[model samples]
Target: MRLEELMNEHYDEFNENDLHILKYVLNHKATSSQMSINQLAEACHTSRSSVHRLTKKLNFAGYSEFKVFLKWESQPAEQESRHTEILTNDIEATMKNLADTNFELLSNKLVSARRIFIYGSGTAQLTCATEAQRLFAVVNTFVTIIHDQVEFETMFPSMSDEDIIIIVSLSGDTPALLPQARKLNAKGIEFISITNLKNNKLAQLSPAAIYVTSSPTATEKGAGLASFIPFHIAIETLIRHFAEYLNV
Candidate 1:
């Protein structure tokens, strides 16, 4: 959560001095990262100790850690200002990430599976359904999408070692989907994931995952769901390679 939200959530917990320090830090968020502890204390008309205490209240180790949050909050504006530069850099970085990905391994997995099941939710489901349908049409692959826990569990009796599951999540922290991922893990059913570049839970849990360079300019919200283009590209890459292996 952002510091502003944090402050609002725990508004009553802070004393007047604490509120002063928090207001100063939040008001000067763009430059707060550069401000020294003493400077912040002086600006807030509080002592360094009060500033230190305020950081602790915010769950940061100290002013330094708090400043890091400030810096992160400030970065998006500067990044967005250089739109063309950011786009070029992100594309170049994404290309490098894609180049480093082992598509051959993914292709091999698909080739060996008797059935392919795709799992995605919300915006991601669109990618899953489209790719599943495309692969089925072009190569006659037996592909299906699992939309919910009920559907997934319903198919579990039919799923076997010869089958493969693919889960796509930008954050890899989908609350409803993670339990199912874990259950599949226990049954020794390996799966693939397409997620963010981070070492997210879904990426670590899956046997294989495709990483995409993190960029959010594409989304109206500029959040986790922002990079559909990257996911779309990665999905298409796998489909194209899988089709080639099937000689379709």
Candidate 2:
């Protein structure tokens, strides 16, 4: 249970003395964990019995357990901050890589394609739709963005040489995209991929790859910190170049 939940659940049960102790705990929870029962009592301007009573009121076995809980509750924010720092550094590196990749050449390819089909599975599909709308709004071209893998592949037979497909995947190893890339390759369809800057199969199969490098340093945070930032920025960057190429 979270410390906040405990306080809310038993807020009414606390007496005036307990309230005084709680105020000290809330204000100094980080430092409170290191302090002894006597130290806490002194800080709260209360007696040891009052400190013991407050811990009991909060349903803790004793002061030690309460302090342990406080310490544990404070750790996630620090870990999250470290995870955020790693992502920031990765973003800088990804931007540098983007700068070195001749986006003008990419723009020429986009401008020449007769039809653009953007396919993104899972979370990245949202960016595909939004970016598709943005591209169409600016370039005023023939474009389609399908979030579903089956729906996108259904149009494969009808796909022509003039058509170009763009794949957006966070992991760059999507099961759904594997077969789709094979289909494109067999039909000699040159495609673009937006994915993590890893030695992944999707990037290897595609004619053009736009990589967004967000290192998975925060294994504890899972996919929460993984980003599609480069996908968004790359799409916008290409659209700007497409505008310049068309003079629109």
Candidate 3:
């Protein structure tokens, strides 16, 4: 797994100070990778112990191991022929994972659920959710789209086993959504996670999960523009299976 993956997996554990240190590291990967723990702490204006704790949260033994991972990410890979080629690879990987996955259980759940709702963790994810809603609506299977955190919290208390939720998230480690995931798990509510291809806390908390491959693009600030095409493909493919299962 990449350093980014490790950080994302433990994202919820990070506090404000940890995030401040993380921001510095992400913005200056090459420099930070070469710096000693003391240098990094000085640069980030935090305590050495704070930096050490951040490394521990990322599952690193210490700063040394964490620096090694950072160095690896900074090393340039052999360039692909084109940006489109990267997306092609992502699609191919996503299809392979989807092919091996059996969607029968999820399709059955959708068919049997009394009410279905879909929520997206971010704007890009919401587009995918909208597509899912439109596709399912064509078959007369109306899906309620949960708009935001407030809406989800309001609806959650009334949700039962007969209801199902489809959560679309890129990292699958969105801090705000994790609490809802835990609530769903504790309440025995059936929810499915559609997340980027990685081991994530949300996927672990859900009853079922669908993984999609995403190609990393250049970062504007700290955010990477990972392609969402795979998400759309996954959603469409899932709905096709659900339609078949519904005999529609």
* lDDT values for all models: 0.73, 0.74, 0.86
> Tens digit of lDDT per residue, candidate 3, span 75-183?
8656775668888988988898688567998998888899999999889888988999999999899999998899999999899988999999998889999999988
Sorting all predicted structures by lDDT, with the top scorer first, yields: 3, 2, 1
In model 1, what are the clashing residue pairs, if there are any? none
- Cα lDDT tens digits, model 2, 213-240, are 6666536546454666656776676667
Q: Where is model 2 poorest over a 10-residue stretch in terms of lDDT?
A: 1-10
* Model 1: how far residue 90 lies from native, Å: 3.7
The window of 10 residues in a row where model 1 has the poorest summed lDDT is 218-227
**Model 3 local distance difference test score:** 0.86
| Worst 10 contiguous positions by lDDT, candidate 3 | 1-10
Error of 1 at 202 (Å): 0.3
lDDT (Cα) of model 2: 0.74
Model 2, stretches more than 4 Å misplaced? 1-81, 217-224
Clash pairs (backbone) in predicted model 3: none
Backbone clash pairs in model 3 (N, Cα, C under 3 Å; residues 3+ apart or in different chains), count:
0
lDDT, candidate 2, residue 38? 97
